[model samples]
Target: MAEKYRVGIIGRTDRGNYGHGLDSVWREIDRAQVIAVADDDERGRWSARSRTGAERAYSDYREMLEQEQLDIVAVAPRWMNEHKDMMLAAAEHGCHIYTEKPFCRDLTEADEIVAACEMRHLKLAIAHQTRWTPTLDVVKREISKGLIGRVLEIRGRGKEDARRGGGEDLWVLGSHVLDLMRVFGGDPQTCYATVLENGEPVTGSHVREGNEGIGPLAGDAINAMYTLPEGATGYFGSHRGTAGDPSRFGIQVFGSEGVVEFLTGHLAPCHVLRDSSWSPGRSRKEWVPISSNGVGKPETLPRTGLHGGNVLAVNDLIDCIGNPEQQPKCSMYDARWTVEMIAGVFESHRTGGPVTLPLKQRENPLTLL
Candidate 1:
């Protein structure tokens, strides 16, 4: 019998909680066991302990880390402010980490986390579940086979609800889109963006504390463009109250020969239009559905939903732990690049021009405004 990896979970209850079922998902992984849980809130701690079937619960995550001999730590908070500390603590304890997204508050925090993990040779995976979806592999294969010849552009957008539109949407939901952008379009070379608040450009006075501890934020509408590899361009935009009927919140990869569109999820809907004209009206082509197996094939993965995605991510982390050469589909470096992309939007807006990649400013750009 193989050794079962002992996992410790960290949550903050009403404050970000066990992000997208990060705690309970461990129950589905037979190779791992949830040994303990930590949450500052008393009720949340006990409730988490029950939910995860953890053997113990602690009020302080630091205390939990010190006492428990954990093989893995789930930094389950959706909130970004606590991510840096929680991740650092996990690394210090020599435990691998699987955490929620929007990696951290800024590039500086992201850099620190990456350095720590790299120093300890710890494998860290972020929950950019879309990257782990089998459909993504099919999409990539199709793109490579010239189904979408010479990918010219990739466009993505957020949910753009009235509340979390623009900057907030960019940070929260945009992270997923940005990650996919890199997957297809390659590393961004430069970003130029415009941020607006009430039909006008955002200024320092407009900046305020964002929800879920995202630090200073401004703008209710954002239009950003990135220069991707091989002359491919990427665009991400969101506006307050502008979401569509079915929610126009996904990525569309446009190529010289055709286009591929996909939503965000482990089993996200994907379609391919094999038309060189790039228009259904001109070519009279049909959009073909894609599944986990291939275009027009049925999904083969036994599990689905966010829970299923967590299982895939956790399994990848375990695999990477056993094989040091492999990295998770949503590796820590990939998560940090998403942060840099989000920061570039603000940095570009602040400078009123294009900002280069690997942003020189590591702090929140809104603060500098």
Candidate 2:
């Protein structure tokens, strides 16, 4: 049996957890023991220790790193504030990483974080579990098989209640959407975004709706769009617009031959699809039947409870650590691109202009004035 990787969780409860679900993903990943947990909040520390059956809990993450000799550290809550430092600390401690999305609020910090991990020769995996989704994997493979003809426009959204998909919609919710876009469209060429934080009626009201269990976000709603390398196009819409209504959330993908409607509610279901043959008048357009293998090739993804997505990412991290040749599915470079895409959204909204990718002015979007 491969030696179990001993892991730790650093980050407190009442600050930046964002209900991210990392606490559970860590528990479900196999052979990876939770040895320690660190949280400034007394309640959070106790809660984490209770969940993982860890013997030690610390008020400071660095102290846990110094004492535990941990093999992996999950920087869960509010990772943005300490992204650079936590990564460096994990590398110095010789541990692998499984961090939250919107890797960091700052695009500039991306290079530094990537460099630190590379210098230490440590395996780093961002918390982009969507890469391991059974459906996603299948769809990607099918696209490669030329079933879709040629990839064209992709449209996706995360309109679940704020509990599922709000708060810094781009950073918290947009990470998954943008990752999916990259999967379908490849790297983006240019990005120009304009968000309406206020919904149709509440233009200036800060009552963003989607986040139900998580907490309130500063903004109301968020929307961003992208342009692809081969003239392909994509769009993303996220908002807390409807607090009382049922969650309306999912991805709608379009290709030359067909379309895919994959929604995450009810455990992320694959819905309707229409091929090139379909028309408005016809009851049955050339239906491109979506099969499990066709979604990307049917396969059972790891189910580690609600946070089942993390199991593959965690396992991959362990594998990467053991094998020098293993490259992560959500690599540091990928994380950087995701950040740039997100930053571009903020830039566009702030400047009222389209901020292209390889953004000429790369700066920290979340830095406080």
Candidate 3:
């Protein structure tokens, strides 16, 4: 019989709680065993164990790691504060990691965490499961088939809802947007952005600490642009209380022949507009839906709600763990570039010019403001 992967979970109820169902999703994986769970809060630990059917629970994650010989761990807390430390601990214990989004506070944190995982030969998967969703593969295949013609530009936006806008919006919602831009446009070569608050450019006074230990942040509105390695240009924008339409909070790929607009969510639908003019009334063609399996109506998809993405991500981790040469869809290296994209926006604003890729500023760019 094949070995069942021993898995542990780490969470903090006070800080985003079990990270969008990371604890429970492992239960769905046939080859995974929920061996133990840890959370700094006593209630969180108990709740996680109860939900996951974990064999043991602890209030301190380090203690759990030291005691359990885990093959994998879900660093489930959404809080950035504990992310770096927890991943480091798991790497030292020689366990693979599956963690939440917006991987860490800054490029510096991403660098260290990735290094630790690499040195230990551990596979680290971030919870950016949009990358794993098969529907996206369909979208990419369509793009390559000239459905959108020669891709020329990419546009993206954050949730920009009332709950969190500006800097918080960028770190939280923008991570997904920026990563998607990379998917369509390739690695960014340079970035130019303007950070704003109350319709004015953000200044040093506007920079402040972020929620859930996201680290220093600035601006309530952001307008950024990037040059993709493929020569396509990418744009990202967000503002407070600007949650226009849920469908609008996604990426659009423009090509010389047509355009593709993608909605963000689990198995989110993508549409193709064949009219090169882009303007609706002026365009000669209409928007049509693309599916994971076919070209028309979306297929009946799995129920991949909040926890669903985690399950898909975990499955990929398990597969990659067994095949050392294969990389998970949302690998640690991909997460680092996402962080760099976020930081580059700020660095561009600070420098009053475009900031080149692989940002020179390793720390949180907002801190420098």
Q: What is the TM-score of each candidate against the true structure?
A: 0.98, 0.82, 0.97
Candidate 2 lDDT score relative to the true structure: 0.67
Q: Top TM-score: which candidate number?
A: 1
lDDT of each: 0.92, 0.67, 0.86
Q: Which runs of model 2 end up more than 4 angstroms from their true locations?
A: 17-19, 26-30, 160-167, 197-221, 239-248, 264-267, 277-281, 285-305, 365-369
- In angstroms, give how far residue 363 of model 2 lies from its true place: 1.6
Model 3, range 253-369, lDDT digits (tens) per residue?
999888898866667777888878887787556788877775677678775756667778888889999988988988999999999999998999988999889987798776777
Better of 2 and 3 by TM-score: 3
After superposing candidate 1 on the true structure, give the runs of residues whose Cα lies further than 4 Å from its correct spot.
300-303
State model 1's lDDT.
0.92
Which candidate tops lDDT? Answer: 1
